[model samples]
Target: MTVTADRFDDALRAGPRVVLQTPEGVPLVMTLASVGERAYAFTIDCLFAAIGLLALLFLSLLTQFAGSSLFGAVFVLAFFLLRNGWFLAHELRSGRTPGKRRAALRVVDARGGPLEPLAVVVRNLTREVEVFVPLVLLANPDFVLDQGPGLVRAVGVVWVAGFALVPFFDKKRRRIGDLLAGTLVVREPRHALQADLVAGAADGEDSRGEPAFEPAQLAHYGVYELQVLEKVLREEPTRSLVLDAVAEKVMRRIGWTGDPREFGGARPFLAAFYRAQRARLEHDLALGRARQSKTAATERGSRPSTMHRNSQ
Candidate 1:
């Protein structure tokens, strides 16, 4: 088969993506974060850290009369803490730092599982060797030696540059920290919910109002599941088997004890469940509770569980 020019253009235009699995045996295509995006995020994080450092510097000047030894020690300790703790605290609390959040990026398990705190620590701490050490060498070559060796400084610089370039070489665009911690930085897909079926149903709808679903029952699923349901509902009505399977899963989740047949059919049952689930999700969204998926880590999260799809 001859490849068309359009196909070649499409291939060239596509960015790097990795395929992960959902618990329900579905395939999820995750887009790797671009170099430009990562750099943007890193710059933002550094800016925030710099602001804190500047504040501490001002405080040190104010307390200069308190003796250089006391405040000098405090300055060093605070510098180290602010420089690293800023990243550790934010990442441990939520996989994404303020920078990652603003960039719409996240760190996920490379092996397709929940991101562990240990992994977060490992990745963030690598900044010491990967970034900090290199920066010091560049700025002050004699950091290690009284008269920093020219060869040694050059070697350090090259090593750091190599680390910086690792992502360009890796198929997944994983850098040193990500490779060591088995994590990946993925960009969240910007997916908007389709036009409100629940609201539209208010006028001509008949199947969704019969069975009342409780908040607790409706809370079993999240935006991810809701989108999947929406995808199904938009297809041709003849795909009854697909609807039946999806409906069964929803019933199991909501602990629907009533018969599926009694609800009329898969279409009606799914419609009712959809209405309840949408209302539940909307309420949560309004309250600033973002549940990307059922298994998504909570602050313990994802959008980039937008890393947490449906899986292990």
Candidate 2:
């Protein structure tokens, strides 16, 4: 448990992190996006809104009989849609609006799960109060000072300040929209192939030795376990005791009652197992067999062939 906690802490410190546990009990750490990144994304969104408004203005000019009131109504509707609906549409589709894509950010549930359409809608709709209302009030000082009474101006100022200050007080930098919607803006986590961990080998032998585990020994774990094992190897390859424990766990899981010294050491055994599992998964993928996580594979009603068997 201490080791698990340490890994979690290390992952969080390595980047901004949202920690979630996989069904197999592995901690999946998703990187949280920085405030600066979110601000940049918002700025990009505002630019898109500006471009949309300009197009609407041009269209209004092109129409001969479109009166000022008609133009005003159309422009307001367009602005509202661009401001709010844009996020709603894009987030629901890919969890990324154009701005978020450009900034390498994505909206997900607070637990780092997939984004829900309802959450996206709620967060974006609340932006009217959290963002635009304050912006509009600040932009048009004359209306507040002259046209609107003192109480109205004061209320606008307070509303703006209160929402703006909410993030400063929250640990995750959650604003009113995020708090209400239970969402998070996080840096998009990219999965890179860990070639370095399995790079060096002779014709088929790892640097330490030839492959120790036979096909049957490698059959007990699937891709998700391989991914976690690969992470452990990459992060702490030299930690022999840690590797031995992992090896023992796998041996028990697969009913392999071999001596620990059979593979020279746990690290080599794990490396050989990793290579085999990776190759199997790649082969399945090439054959158009969709292998998601182990849980997903089970849920899809297709048991994994080759070396992937249900683990204990």
Candidate 3:
């Protein structure tokens, strides 16, 4: 089903997808990272940090590290950087930490674009206010409870508690950092697309069957063409302008000048072409004629016949 721009709502509950329009008026769908996935990524990141701290301590003790004075200074610096710099550097560079990459997740612009460096900084800074500062206090209960000022301690407790629980209230699973930064944690899209672009053609023709593409027609494309076509299909808006554009290009490539109306819609026509092209490539592969791209197919001297045409 097509999600129209007019009725574009995140409240659909159909899935964790955020469907928005890009600056170029393209309908973009971003799959939000699931809560479980985010949690798993977080746990892994914490594990790495802990392991790093332990390794530092082990090294310092092994060499005595010029006594406690030098070791204490170095330990504090390492702890601070590990707690803060790790997230900042990774996000600023690639928007994905080691954990996020492992979990197939990355941070992105909530409005559907590239992650900004400022946004990364803001989000990670907010993270300190939300979690790490409170954690530091909690780790030292003797000071917070017995010696620290009651009001400051209470406020710190409340600040961290509220931020911690707020994401549970949000459907998007956005924390204080995400809200401030206008960023989203999204699962990465896979390169290979499913073959469900057109349903009827995959099984039986409903009433209008698209014309079968001959081996010569299929030979106009290869694996690269299949990938591009899939991307077009995935990102096509409710208006379906891209669909027509790509369908026209495919028709010209295969030299099919038959009635466009006969194909029913551009989706089915493209789906038919995709299926045929994929099948042709697979068949060629079985015979050791592996065509990796359209350029490779061309290098093999494929002779497409425009003289012969198929009509439904």
Candidate 4:
């Protein structure tokens, strides 16, 4: 019943530890943005909205458009665009609004894939209902307790409280919109991680000879296990004891045969294994059968073989 790291391998999958798995199956670990962080990002976005509103105001003044019916219609349209379209346009195009990017956060699917249009629209539109409307109603002096209907003001208070409180109760710190839309907000991964993993593994002396793994050997484990091996190999080569022990553990897990001592050295065995696994992952990706974690792989296996490779 024990869950191992290989149990789930969607690298870009969001969690407390954000793991961004590339198309080639390399994983870059990241951290999830906190609720406080999310608030800061939102505040930054509000600043952008404010600036947009100011621009519209300036345009109205210069064009003598203020106080005219035409200006009122234009103002409403601009508000809708700056309020709703701002989030929709930015999230759909790049998965990050200006606020999110400044906060080093990006939105992704719960399963660690790219954001889809439906999800983007749902989350942002819901924000209007859950956040904007209630705030505007409550904050407007015309709608205050002494000036407006008691029932309406009371309803506004309750609506804001409920929606704003949902995130605090969820384990993932998900807002109501995020829960409904199946989305998560997480920190962006460091840019250098990919280069470090690939570049270090590519040093000529590390994996000098051509890999000699058989098809069966390569099939025993998928990208998840290969990533674990990569981490081990990337450790200091002079730490022979650690390398040997990790290599032996990996071999046992994958049912790899032959003595480590006979394969030049533990480091070489690891390097060659990495080469084979990476090559296999690349081939599988090209075949449109990209490697998934144990759970996804099992689910995939249960489906009919006639299913196309791209479906995986």
Give the number of the best model, judged by TM-score.
1
How would you encode candidate 4's per-residue C-alpha lDDT over 152-183 as one tens digit per residue? 76775786667877777877777888998998
- 1 versus 4: better TM-score goes to: 1
RMSD of each: 14.7, 11.7, 15.8, 9.6
Q: How many backbone clashes can be found in candidate 2?
A: 2
Candidate 1: tens digits of C-alpha lDDT, residues 64-181? 7336777778778878897889888998888888999999998888777778899999998887777776667667767744455678767867877677678888888888898899
Every candidate's lDDT: 0.74, 0.70, 0.71, 0.71
Best by lDDT: 1
Candidate 2 residue lDDT tens string, 1-312: 124334534334544456665456676656777777888998898898799888778777797525778778877888877877888888889988899999988887886455677888888888887777667767875654566777887886886768866766777777788988898777875677656655645445444455555666655555556666776777765656788888778777767676656666777777776777777766766776635444554556443232232221
lDDT by residue for model 3 over 190-257, one digit each (tens)?
Answer: 66756565454658753586678777787776554565565566667634876777778778878998
Return the lDDT, model 3, position 41: 84
What is candidate 2's local distance difference test score?
Answer: 0.70
Off by over 4 Å in 4: 1-15, 18-29, 141-156, 191-312
Candidate 1 — what's its lDDT?
0.74
- Name the lDDT value of residue 2 in candidate 2: 25
User: Candidate 3: which stretches are off by over 4 Å?
Assistant: 1-15, 66-68, 134-159, 189-312
Error of 3 at 235 (Å): 24
The model with the greater lDDT, 1 or 4, is: 1
Candidate order by TM-score, decreasing, is: 1, 2, 3, 4
User: What C-alpha root-mean-square deviation, in Å, does candidate 4 show against the real structure?
Assistant: 9.6
Which pairs clash in model 1? 297-300, 297-301, 302-305, 302-306, 303-306, 304-307, 305-308
Please say which candidate is ahead in lDDT: 2 or 3: 3
